[model samples]
Target: MSSSLIFTFIFTLCLLSSCFSSSASLHNATDENVTLRPQHEIQKLKLIREHLQKINKPTVKTIQDPKHGHWWLQFGSGTLVGYWPVSLFTHLMEHGNMVQFGGEIVNTKPGGSHTSTQMGSGHFAGEGFGKASYFRNLEMVDWDNTLIPTANLRVLADHPNCYDIRGGVNRVWGNYFYYGGPGKNSKCP
Candidate 1:
């Protein structure tokens, strides 16, 4: 056979052999005994629904901003907190969302200043109040180049009191908070 034809044949054989080896390995590693538990799945679904309901359906209306995608839960005369990306805020406003009761997002700075610093949570430790354990900012563009928003929820396994939830445009700039346990504020460390 010509050198070029021989080389092509060898390459094709190598590719087919690799594919078969991968398939065989995958098949061999399959766990036939593993079964999904329906009860556990249902319980998880129920928990999620409960969480959603707490934050969404309230006796009052949720606040929304027309210019920027910031949402807030209003009470009495002041705004409790504002969420970026807007969708997560809307989700919290839905009936039967449990996340609504988790916490509120207080915009430390009114009128949405790009560089203004805001304080949240009644208690303060120096200047790091309301600082996110995982992220630094709320705009999705800051975390990623894309304008899309994402949400992250982390629950500490060892410490039942430690929990954090953040959602917004940038992973770096989002609303996040942690509470419960000894030295819970230092959990990010």
Candidate 2:
């Protein structure tokens, strides 16, 4: 396996271990036959598990309930990254419907000219595996509360000449995609 992939797996395992260990410590039987978490902790780990299952259900439409707050984690390291809370938009009665993956950048050049910028590895998707930027083992949570390979995945490139994306699946990578390119190329400009 690639070093980067091994590192990612180790990092993810560490984060999950930490989360589980902390939450598990809070689970204890009380004399009154009720196990309760601290008041400061509004939503415990159970809530997170329930939310994950609920969101994956086909009948469920909302992604988040404002009543139960949510945070996105940027786990760069054990301490460097933190949780970022999201505020609901006015139009979103309950939560968001669409989820997007990938990168976006604006062309600030005047006269509709392309800028000499690079996206992921500074190579086009056509450059193939090791030469291009890619994402691998992509999966989505299912109603069964288990992770499943992404289905009906879509790929799009606003400026194909400047940047592009190609999707594929394999036993090793599962649902994977190679993307990105050098901007302001002869074909792009």
Candidate 3:
């Protein structure tokens, strides 16, 4: 790991303890609609968006549902740094939004598309970018993290405790792991 990677792990490690204090499934807890509650995390989401935009300059979508009371911001439809794609970060953003908005993230596969959101299906399935359903992290589904030259650099920007929930076991697994999502599998140790 590089110095930056190590430093990032340390930063997110501080958030892990509080991120998973409760489990709020990305899918509905009981009904198909996962309840949405007011979140004090707009600042949190903004920080994430700012970091991605400043570093990669990918297109970002921001939405707030006061009726439902949540903020869903997603990034995708482009590449960042040629190797690392914004799609990878999109998944993590989805989870982070959930946690910030007071809900659990559904443990979708590392490369699976983001779907099964609180409002029935993810944003990707509805209209297009910014739909906010489980927003599809990638415009190109076939592309994998391997396409990125160094997973450590883009994915690990400032998050080290990240994990890929779909990886099955605990520990840093998969390139998605570097994204630092707020899922049980993605928590920092």
Task: Report the lDDT of model 2 for residue 144.
Answer: 32
For all candidates, the clash counts are 29, 0, 9
lDDT top scorer? 2
TM-score for candidate 1: 0.17
Q: Alpha-carbon error at 45 in model 1, in Å?
A: 42
lDDT of 1 at 59: 22
TM-scores of all candidate predictions against the true structure:
0.17, 0.55, 0.19
Over 1-189, each residue of candidate 1 has an lDDT whose tens digit, in order, gives 112110000011123234334222212112555432223435433433343234321222234444554444443235464443555444323222222213223333344432122112223222232222222222122211233232554433332223333333333334434322222334322
Q: Model 2: per-residue lDDT, tens digit, 95-164?
A: 3344445655578888788987787656889998546766666754333334456777789999999999
Candidate-wise lDDT, in order:
0.30, 0.53, 0.27
Off by over 4 Å in 1: 1-70, 73-76, 79-85, 88-93, 100-180, 183-189
Q: Which ten residues in a row have the lowest lDDT in candidate 2?
A: 1-10
- Candidate 2 achieves a global lDDT of 0.53
Better of 2 and 3 by lDDT: 2
Each prediction's RMSD over C-alphas, in Å, is 25.2, 16.0, 18.7
